[model samples]
Target: MTSARRTVHGTTIGIIVLDTAFERLPGDIAHAETWPFPVQFRVVRGVRPADVIEGDASLALAAFHEAIDDLVSLGARAITTSCGFLAAVQDELTRYSPVPFFASALLQIPLIERSLPAGRRVGLVVSDANALQERHFRNVGAEPGLPIAELPADGPIRANMRDNAQQVDRAAQERDALETVERLLAAHPDVGAIVLECANLPPYSDAIARRFGLPVYDIVTLVTWLHNALVPPRYRV
Candidate 1:
């Protein structure tokens, strides 16, 4: 609710969050500073990270819808979530939301794929490679066969998410993220662009892009696009 943000981006964006206890570093969607525009967050009650990744978020459909209602009531023009695994429920939640609902950064896959050169395709860096299912891509309108990678489970990035730790080891995170991107690129030479499916991965987006020399897209970009559509800047003609 900063006046500075209001002057630049008029409306508020709502973020549906999972119930967890992790330090959200700058650039993480849950971190308020990650957004240039103002945002409102609603934690879907009792919905944990496991529920999102393991359950595919289908079990919490009604809860997510309820959160959307609350946010819409609070003047939120668009809605998004803190977890990329929410892509599993993207189709249904989008249909149920009163306003625009961007459930996951994975939403960028289809567009990125189509935007890439003929021989290149979009590659994904996800939080849990094992948890990703075909339905996640299908629900977001992304075609199957796109390559994917995961943060090392033992690394600070994945460890913090798993333990919901408040302290972050940033250097370690960057290293792990960079290595993950290297693996993704090495495995898929035709990858023209990189899409981070996990909302937390934006913190390392710049590093990934710099190291891999590929355009990286995440929730931040997706939300910025929505923010622009909802409240375009005024230009003095």
Candidate 2:
């Protein structure tokens, strides 16, 4: 019989991650580990941005599709990609896959917007502002030109976060992220909710919420919701 045909008390959710050497940046992996349901992972090798401006999405989709097939074979009930940029092909990916799939954390934008009153808006904290465009915003049912903020993943800022992930300077990384969120909120007072664009930032979700006094949404939360609905704990064996 097929893997999908086999029933278990719990269901597995597959996460497709980027091919990066960084081990501590496994936000998706960490999220899956903490999930209430069973989780499986399938990595796609060697997919990265070249010039920052020029992205090879075709290569990304190829890796993603291959990973999906493997996960389905392993009996994954649903799939979620690790990065927000993957939303570019979310519609296509979901259409092609037999299982439920979520491509981006920004998918929560529409729900967030609907929950809030007018004048108050959701803010996006992205690793790369230039890469986030109207296409991504609209995909999640967010208005174009919504309050968005970006912090480049470079310089001492990124270095601090990276070092913290390695356990070299945890305090420094926390401080840097806190400062960045403070600055972002100062710049956009009307932002009622915050969406963390970088998967790495979700670790500081509590900090961000406390500092800004707003609901914070990240890829982790999005995956958790999808996992719960698509693969409930009772369904896992």
Candidate 3:
């Protein structure tokens, strides 16, 4: 048991990804190139995109726990999921996790809000506005009524993501993303920072920040923070 505790080494972060067939771009969490450090990924096979997003994740709890145990044995010290909507299962999964677990980028909402000046609030850009509920926020300890924007599922970009298309139109995705941000800003001008609730949305983060000049947060930022904490940079002091 001792010798087999860790079959791998030097990898600190383990990612739990859903069964997705969609194209994962360079900034997407599931894309290995997205991370600067090494990470181990365990896909909870048979768990589909719509199942986790629109349906209850309770049915997949057993599979999730199994994945956690598997990753831990593989030398992963921290774990995170590829889906942002999985925040609904945050408490349950964190308790079951052997290591620190971050269920969603939405978890950063509270801390980001606290950092904001008065009258300003952190805005959210989620994959499906209609599917996100109050419980997802409560599970992650974020305010329930915060301003949120959604990339309309009816649009070609989000539809492909929801349906898990093997390929995606990058140009159309970018245009839709910027338009979504425009709508969000129009509705709530007091939005201080924007948080992307879709793991695949990170590719457009830089574009959002460049156009709106607001700080954007996503799975990449969350994972990087977790990795840095687990493996701090060495300094010759």
Model 3 agreement with the true structure over 61-162: per-residue lDDT tens digits: 999999999999999999999999899999999999979999899989988999998999999998888889989999988778888889987876678877
For each candidate, the alpha-carbon lDDT, in order, equals 0.87, 0.70, 0.91
Q: List the residue pairs that clash in candidate 3.
A: none
lDDT (tens digit, per residue) of candidate 2 on 1-237: 533354333546877766544434334344454555677766677664331214746556667788998888777878886677676677778888999888788888889988987888888877677787777766666677877777646634355433433333444545666777777778888888888876666767777788768899998888778866764566556
Instruction: Kindly provide the TM-score of model 1 when superposed on the true structure, using C-alpha atoms.
Output: 0.93
**RMSD (Cα, Å) of model 3:** 1.4
Q: Rank the candidates by TM-score, best first.
A: 3, 1, 2
| TM-score of every candidate relative to the true structure | 0.93, 0.83, 0.96
Candidate 1 lDDT tens digits, 20-76: 898888998989888887888898879998899977578789899899988887778
Quote the positional error of residue 1 for candidate 2 in Å. Answer: 9.1
Per-prediction backbone clash count:
0, 7, 0
Instruction: Compare the candidates by TM-score and give the number of the best one.
Output: 3
